[model samples]
Target: MWSVVLLWLSCVPAGLQAAAVYRRDVPHQKVEVYSVTLDCTVTSRFAHTVMTSKALNKANSSQEIFFDVDLPKTAFITNFSMEIDGQLYVGNVKEKEKAKKQYDKAVSSGQTAGLVKASGRKMEKFSVSVNIAALSSVVFTLTYEELLQRKLGHYEILTRVKPQQLVQEFKIVVNIFEPQGLAFVEAEASFLTNDLLLLVDKTVTDKKAHISFTPTLEQQRTCPGCEGSIIDGDFIIKYDVKREKSLGEIQISNGYFVHFFAPPDLPRVPVNVVFVIDRSGSMSGIKMQQTKEALKAIFDDLHEEDHFALIIFDNKIIKWRKYLSKATQQNITAAQSFVKRIKDNGSTDVNSALQEAVKMLKNGHRKNTIPERSTDMIILLTDGNPNSGESSIPVIQKNIQAAIAGNMSLFCLGFGNDVDYSFLDVMARENLGLARRIFEGSDAGLQVQQLQSPLLLPGNLA
Candidate 1:
């Protein structure tokens, strides 16, 4: 897990919620933020960074100050520390049981302590509070590392800023070094304005780039009245590198060498896709409509080089065609009509449905009807647990594994909160694929479009 675990004399008010930055300054909040800086260094595929925050308590009595930052869930926190009037305290790792006991003791006795938790899909929330002595200052420093993953085309690194009060010095610096060569660099921020664009400096060369965002106190204000800080969004940096066809870019340093190869402009690998959908009675009303809409859009995105099959299951499995059909216009139209006529009824038979889909793909590959160069994939979408035919998760997983034997990738989409997502996730991972949660909403269909993921275009590094 890419999580940051911190233990110290950290505490928060009983009812305070987790937040990256305060949206607005509270009247009794006497902590004054003087300076803040976040620096990121990226070398090829890995990134390491630190965040430093300095604040002073101005009230006559001690007050609580929080250090909150949001980071990608795929990042690792290496170190965390706090300095109070020159006395420093650092976090040390401990066994889970021991740590839990210590945390409970601190909280029960009304001593300072805090907890870390997830915030969103891509980001984890790291928050801690410490009581600052009156008229004294505190410094909080955090360091972390992550392996950058390229999506679509570029790699992105970002920081969330929610400093409720304007600081005299607020700066962010990102330095990236690519072994091949710098293709292009772009800087953006949710809170960036026309006038603030000048502060977003970008300097690029052959293999290195330095991007900075240094906004002044006046620029960070929400308005002339200064009711809240305007620096309340993400500061994101995106960039890519030049690539060679075969030899790629190999860099030797210290004693070891690394080779990075991402072949550019390669034709999309032809795929025989089996979309296994659930029409169990639970999938009625808007859920059914959204699934239909999503499927139609997906069919439209199919390429001539691809072949697809549609299978809908309730208690019994139904197929639109007896075999995998080319993504020609006629076949797509027929599939769409079959989907529009689908009605929700009967109990879920997830295990049998999956096994049947896998059987179809395996049979096609064996019959030589599907091209030898084409890949077979099962995109299974369901909103409920198995209720018929091998309902046991372990049995279903073992049976499917034996049937496919790693011959095809199985991607699972668990729709709505009612799904046992972990069950689906394990099945996908066991079969050379991944699982995704399709959130229940109007945009549910759009989420299905994410099927065109990094799995399609893989970059090799050694």
Candidate 2:
């Protein structure tokens, strides 16, 4: 009986040792890491790691203290659940999954795995997501493909993450596959809604190339009871650095266009013009000659559809035209002939000419009936003071007020020293136009250029 008992004890010790080894090898609940990748592009390529976790507690005891992971400062996270000690924590799990997928795909495709000497290119960074608690056994495997391309001859890959219907983030990673070299970098973004916020980060391992930046955004914000406000945001940017030739050239083209095109689209409203010229005695010499030349240029530049009329103020108000005409060859030639025939006459009646121009624009003759066209315009040019009908500046101003009530634009040009520039400036401001002074010795061509430059083209006319 004693011998049998000793044999049993020895076997018992062996059995206990086997059980301990089994427990050490087997986990109560497995933690597996799976990869998900996002395929798209982001504006800026900043280096950072993103962590994602999901846990399933099958124990009936409802135990807490499940998982913990460190997060990077510049990383974005969403759709993750956290349970500390005993309770479930609700956060953004969707965003977490999206971020995970982006990173995983980037890693598996060899796009973000560091440099590969065989291809003469290297994977600089990756976008990846970690999936835990999905499989019963702790197993890790890559699960996505990434599409990579060369932009302006530089290696770059884009990854997109859609966490919610209204929210999204893009990750653009550039692989400096070449040896250390200098590169230029720029970035921009356009969102469907105004409230979306964007974050951009860039880093260069080596310094060798010059960088230029041009950024633009077409932003629209909604207001209560008011129509949406459209704003164009543009920034001029430049940077220079040096590095290796192996990285090639990183050309990001989407961020390139806004540097050139945003400003011209904003606040460009059509202009209204009224030609008020002096056909008086003082303007008879080269002054009148230059005036006519300037007038012809103005006529030539007028949009075919713009609103304009000619009122030559001399001893009397000569209303040669009552409606704006296209700058067609025929109309311009006829207008030019009329301007040439304008001889130095008795006295200057500036007030009468202004009144008549305003009257013609306000009356809206048969030829001036385009729908939705902007305000009418009256361009006034003169070389002498009011010496005829309604010479009072106040009376001329009253006519101008009436024109404004009708929504007109008034521009004034004064030639020689005889005209009143102060009054011209007042008229221009009242009607949202410009007032300019042309000296006797000034180049008439230059004056013409200035006058014609501001007139809207036919395509620009509303």
Candidate 3:
């Protein structure tokens, strides 16, 4: 018998340290940020997600502040602006080198050099120093796109909230319009939801959806005597269009649109995939057993047109085939036998394993031009830190980046808390991919299947 344990980890830092900047004109007493006002507008037409955060300063002086905004990895921002005292300063996208120069100039000139950077784990941190003019507030707004995703026959959007301190006021309003008739709408939150209001148009003719969720910490019994309510976690919304068919649905109203693409009828683009498995000593027990079961099950789902390869690594690299092979029944049976024979023993040689996977994909691409139109992916599963050949993360990431060379996507699965998930996340981000952490106690095989099922394409709006 095998027992699995599920570990819930904090995805965000405990708190942000926004130290006060001292100056002659600055107030001697520390300024407290009393309230944070958040307004978000998500649309499906262009699939844009725009958000504005206003921070009010209580003390009568300038204050320095920093906050991290966590968004989906698919999001890309094109506009960033700050509004202060009825004046707006907008920032334009510039080359990395030019942007650095401009930022430096603003700082040296005693101007507000607000910085926005993509931190690890799908979060962006914004830092700015401004004079609030004694009890005033500064508003920062960023506009981005690619917040809509499709899963399990529905469209989904996620909004994260993790303010270390409770603000006086925090409100979030979302307006959605679907032409296919507002079929179904639902919201899920880890915090209290009694304060949230969902107003839907009963008349099918309206074809619109609106959701407003506000958290009230004062009424919470979990943390009593705390001025603000404990609000920390994600606010997720999932909705489905009423239409029965898999054909996508779109809705337009007042020059704005939201689309739900669920094309189950369309033939999936053929895929050439490589499953890179780790057989290090740490994975010797239930981990290895679950992995083998997962691989065998996945092989059964491969279409005839799709091709696959299997490579398991420890101290040395092992390949199931010299080149990619068809997903024929006989071949799949042979692969299952190969997977069953893989016993964990040696140390982890991630560097070599990744290189070999990329090499195989590149060679396969060169030999078969048809797969160029298809998607090439490497699903790497690792459970231990690299201890053999080229162990440094930077070196391994660089080599893998060079080998893939923007041609293929890499999906990483870190098994359990023992693996370095940060490394996987960064590498996947750089390679136009994503990494998922698989908990041990749960259905490990099911998680693997979920990650690979229906394979999301690059820039896929679903």
Please list the Cα RMSD from the true structure of every candidate, rounded to 1 decimal place: 8.1, 30.1, 12.3
Give the lDDT ranking, best first: 1, 3, 2
CA lDDT, every prediction?
0.76, 0.44, 0.65
Q: Is candidate 2 or candidate 3 better by lDDT?
A: 3
Q: State model 3's lDDT.
A: 0.65
C-alpha root-mean-square deviation, candidate 1: 8.1
Q: Which ten residues in a row have the lowest lDDT in candidate 2?
A: 1-10
Candidate 1 stretches with Cα past 4 Å from truth are: 1-153, 157-165, 168-184, 188-234, 247-261, 281-290, 365-368, 453-462
Error in Å for residue 395 of model 3:
1.0
Give candidate 2 misplaced runs (Cα > 4 Å): 1-272, 365-372, 457-462
For candidate 2, write residues 1-462 as lDDT tens digits: 000000001111111111111012233332321221222222223222232332333444322212222221112232333222333333321222243353344334322111101111121111222222222211111112222222243333222222111101222233322222335544333332334333333454444222222112222223444323222222212322232323233444546321111123344444456688888887777678778867866766665545555777776776777565555677767877887888877787877777777666556643444335555667777754776777788777777667567476677777764457788888777776667766444455555554454444322211
Candidate 1 is scored at a TM of: 0.62
Q: Which candidate has the highest TM-score of all?
A: 1
A best-first ranking of the candidates according to their TM-score comes to 1, 3, 2
Tens digits of per-residue lDDT, candidate 3, 1-462, equal 222111111121222122332222333244543445444444453356666666766666555654346665455566766665566667555433344565565445545444444444344444445445556666777676664545687777777776666555566666776655667777777774454323211222346666675555564323567644456777777776565565566566789444556544455777788899999998877678777766765777777777889999999988998899877888889999998998989899998998898889888988883366778888888874888999998988898898888988888888754668899988987786778766443456555555555343322334
